[model samples]
Target: MKTIYYLFGLVVMAVLTLVSCESKPSLQKYFVEKSQSNEFMAFDLGTDIIKAAGSDNLSADQEKALKAVRKLNILIFKSDSTDTNVVHYKEETTKVKSILKNGDYEELMRVGSGKEGASINMLGENDDIDEFVVFLRKDGVFGLIRVLGDEMTPTDVLTIMQLVEKSGVDMAQLQPALNQINGNKG
Candidate 1:
């Protein structure tokens, strides 16, 4: 009887191991760590964020992007330790419009309202700490991606946006689900 019980336990353990391994998503393959102005941050489909090196600040787009991600892995920058001042403002200029001139991703209609989506711009004029006001889809679906740096550099923001675009997420499918969550009548 003991032999039979031991055999059963071994089989259960093996099955459990296989089940756990299979639960990992295929998107995990895309994660990659890259060097940034802040320190080192990873980017990819599975990676939702890369924290500001030892600082509380995150670029506007980074914060918004993380919210939409179902799974996230963040690498904190370890080198830079300086603190900068964060300024908050609402402005109507596409200051970094040129960064997204390629226009690979098209904008979707807002789920509930037709109003233009809001955007965040964080500036550190005094070399304090950079911050950004982030834009998010109020319907909880999608929004414009924004990332702030010492200045809104063309490459940094574009890099983050491209990573998000390539994540194989079917935004069209996600929109309806998001609208349902928000209880959108429209």
Candidate 2:
């Protein structure tokens, strides 16, 4: 009787293990895991970073947009096109592509070929997008950016990002990572 019970318990454990491992993965989960790896660069920026650009000069609409956004998550796998780097870039970028394509995200734009490309996707229905995702791949670099918010319209995001172009946003937290990725370019 004891042996039979032990065998039954073992079978149950095996099934549970397989089931847990078989669950579908998500882009958010990928970010959480890879952000810790030394091979990748991660930045979790809150609304303050955007406000830093020029909060005092912001229009009413811009302020509303800024408040709607909760945070931005950026993950980058930078490479210089070595054989090992090529392999890592392909693997990580492919995983991200799979997650975005297969998940609930709706593609807003996609440009480029197998070797290089950029894609924009959003989650949520028309005029009420909650998250906007952009992934870009160049010859020696790949990056993912997630703009998470609550009930943000497309226009709102555009308004806030325009502030970044004016060049007042702080890059202190991103300087090191930016240095690593762009250092060899020029």
Candidate 3:
């Protein structure tokens, strides 16, 4: 009886150890506090999807539209990886746009593709913008973050984009993490 109990304890301890050692992968976090308007979003490169949610003023259709994007992963490719690649991910972002009709606000969305990216094109929208957003990883981890308010300026937006380009989660780090979690070698 004593040996059986010891074996059971060892098994429980092993399981707990595995669980604790599991890495918690998160999306690259990009946050800009005390700047820009009210905006919240997450672009999961792993899943090739972009999600933005904010304000009750949005219409049902807009919410549906946000959910409609089943595939947009092509947006996360490296710019210089292939020169012959016709559909360059970096430049492709300019062609992307979405409209959101929240309860009291109309959101015009524009997300960039490459390392340097931008979302929530609110400068031309309401005179006073208030928003907070994040770029979530495919694993549902939070990555880049953006919080904008009345104090956010156009230059601030540009600066934020630059920062994202310089430091957003790169594929180099992500692929290995995914492989480790899924027990597959890339």
Candidate 4:
């Protein structure tokens, strides 16, 4: 009886240890997992794509910002009241917010209100910015843009934005995806 009890205790301890070793799911992991259901569209771009999109005449600030950016992950979901995934969307958004709240992320900016909301948050130490998360919700559609970088600053993001605006990247290309999310067969 004593030997049997010791074995049972060892099994219980092993189970507890495994449970404690599990790490929290990251934003990227959530995006990838939930996207498999076809409720969201995921776009991932590397540094090379960003570099190629810009002009050769990039300013010093723009160059610095572009170089600092290592990767970009975007997930867009169009609100469909009739779809079952709407529940998942709400749950996933709450999870993301909870994760951010528990971390050292700081709000950089916020715009709009009510049903339309947009915010930018950053995670970093001191002057070195590590990640920039942009959450935008408008007209029943939601979008998340995660910019991962090394030693980035707020000013660097501004410069990169300006470069993107001038690069003639077709903004209309995204309209079809947005329309699909809105249940508009375009």
Candidate 5:
């Protein structure tokens, strides 16, 4: 009887493990893999975004929204020249698009076609959001911004966008990518 009970416990544990394991490709896995390559530049804007994003002249709601954010994962594609860079840019862009389109994320907004466009996607329920993803593709360059938090509300995300639109994200963090993109354009 003891042996039978132990076997049953083991069986239940195995079943639970199998059920919890993720089988499909995930955006996070892609981020890790691409970050190692020379073609991509990755940055983590830590929890202290108030400092990084420049908290000057922000409203109460904006400040609150910014505080709700935990961190941001940014991945920008880099190339030496626009003429020669289309190969990897398109490839990585396609991978990101595929992940977002097929994954369980909900789309907030999308515009443009394959050559140039932008998209915003979110994961989790309406009230308790887990992560927000923003993808931008233009001028033969592309970038992915993953906003990670514990339980950000939809209003928080909207206010954050408003804050960014009004004040813009800290340019220091994005300067390198901007420079690289400009250089590639020529």
Candidate 6:
């Protein structure tokens, strides 16, 4: 009886190990792999940068939301239908869709469609949100923004977005980088 019980326990452990190992790949890993090849433009912003970008005019809720955020990762891919690398664009879009669908992510909201598409998604376990993902495809550009936060709620995300829109940060600072990605001279 003891031998049988021990063998059953071992089998259960092996099954659990295999199941954990087979879990879907993280979105962060996918972003890093695609950005490392120089085919995509990537930006990583730590908490300090995010905090500094916010103004003193932030509301209590907005301030709390910002404090919960640990980091932000942005990846952009510019593709034109007439471009030779359009095939690569299609592959990337497909890969992103598959990853989101297969992973634990849940679609929070979706806006626009076809060429002008955008969506917001979240990856969470229990009541804690681990990451927030935003994918926007407009014109010939594809952009992904991943916000890593702790104990984030839906209200917190809304406040964060509101703060971002109201923040006086100058987006023109990114014009040079955007132009480079779009094959335009600054």
**Which lDDT tens digits does candidate 1 get at residues 72-154?**
23222221223321110111112222222223222322223332354344333423323333433322222333233344343
lDDT per residue as tens, model 4, 85-183:
567667766676776676667887889986688888888864689899998877667888899999988788777777666664454656666576668
| C-alpha lDDT of all candidate models, in order | 0.36, 0.85, 0.36, 0.75, 0.81, 0.77
Candidate 5 residue-wise lDDT, 1-186, digit = tens: 999999999999999999889678788998898889877878788755434244576678766787778889988886555565777776778788889999989999999985889999999998889999999988767889999987799899888777666555667766766766676532
TM-score of each: 0.25, 0.79, 0.24, 0.73, 0.83, 0.78
* RMSD (Å) of each candidate, 1 decimal: 21.2, 5.8, 19.0, 5.9, 3.3, 3.4
Candidate 2: deviation at residue 96, Å? 0.9
Candidate 2 on 12-113: residue-level lDDT in tens? 999999988866889889999998997788888887775344458777888888888999999988876689988888888889989998999999999998
Residue 17 C-alpha lDDT in model 3: 97
Q: In model 2, what is the error at residue 74, expressed in angstroms?
A: 0.6
lDDT of 1 at 104: 24
Error of 3 at 54 (Å): 34
**Candidate closer to the true structure by TM-score (higher is better), 4 or 5:** 5
Which ten residues in a row are the worst by lDDT in model 4? 46-55
Q: What TM-score does prediction 1 earn?
A: 0.25
- Model 3 worst lDDT run, 10 consecutive residues: 26-35
Kindly give the stretch of ten consecutive residues in candidate 5 with the minimal lDDT sum.
46-55
Give candidate 5's TM-score: 0.83
Which residue pairs show backbone clashes in model 6? none
Per-model tally of clashing residue pairs: 9, 0, 33, 0, 0, 0
**Candidate 2: regions farther than 4 A off:** 1-22, 51-54, 183-186
lDDT of 3 by residue, 1-186 (tens): 999999999999999999988543211111122112122222323212222223254455433332332222111222223554333432332222211222222344535553444444342333334443333222211133334344444444444444345335355635744444454547
Q: Please tell me which predicted candidate would have the highest lDDT against the true structure.
A: 2
Which segments of model 4 are wrong by more than 4 Å?
A: 1-22, 47-54, 83-85, 171-176, 182-186
- Judged by whole-model lDDT over C-alpha atoms, candidate 1 comes out at 0.36
Which ranking of candidates, highest lDDT first? 2, 5, 6, 4, 1, 3
- Global local distance difference test of model 4: 0.75
Worst 10 residues of 6 by lDDT: 46-55
